[model samples]
Target: MTEFSSILSTSNIRGAYKSSQELTTSPVAPEPQGTGESFADVLRNAAQSTVETTRQAEAVAQQGLTGKVGAQQVVEATLELESTVKVMISMRDKVVEAYQEIIRMPI
Candidate 1:
């Protein structure tokens, strides 16, 4: 979760939506190329990471059941998975809020 927060703090969501002014303006400035990760790409990567974390946690739990993994490791994995899920949910809420705000804007 801290890692996700830090990433959010450092980068802006690009190419998510373009305003009418942005689309209609003449003499528009060229966009600067950078790391090239679109908003969808970032979301996809985060979702993949969350899935991987969940799988790992499940694996750890299974190992614990078989007495191969330590209780501490299983607990840690479960906590990490929980945090990842919470962060994803928070992000989803924020995105929905942003969409609603955009919808409320005067045309």
Candidate 2:
């Protein structure tokens, strides 16, 4: 896991140039500096990540609850799942506020 994390760090991933035979590259496109983004985009990404994390956690829980994995693994997975949920709720609130402000704007 140490080697995996070392290779997966943002700096390490960004350091090496992509080879010609590589099928895929960076996970995200470059975010332009000092430019604002649409609230919808932010919310979309947050929701997608949350769903993915929750799915993984459920898989881990199933493994543990069925005696296929350790209890500690289940606890850690549950914690990660909770954190993702909190993030989604915060994003949802922000999106709602932005929508309300747009609605109140005068023509």
Please give each candidate's TM-score.
Answer: 0.67, 0.60
**lDDT value for model 1:** 0.63
- Which lDDT values do the candidates have, in the order given? 0.63, 0.61
Candidate 1, residues 1-107, lDDT tens digits: the string is 34544333222223111211222233345446774555677677767867877898899999999999987667666666676677778778878999999999999
Candidate 1 has a TM-score of: 0.67
lDDT of 2 by residue, 1-107 (tens): 34544433354233221211121222367667666555455556656766777898899999998999987667666766765676567656866898899999998
Which stretches of candidate 1 lie above 4 Å from their native place?
1-31
Evaluated against the true structure, the overall lDDT of model 2 is 0.61
Residue 76 lDDT in model 1? Answer: 63
* TM-score between model 2 and native: 0.60
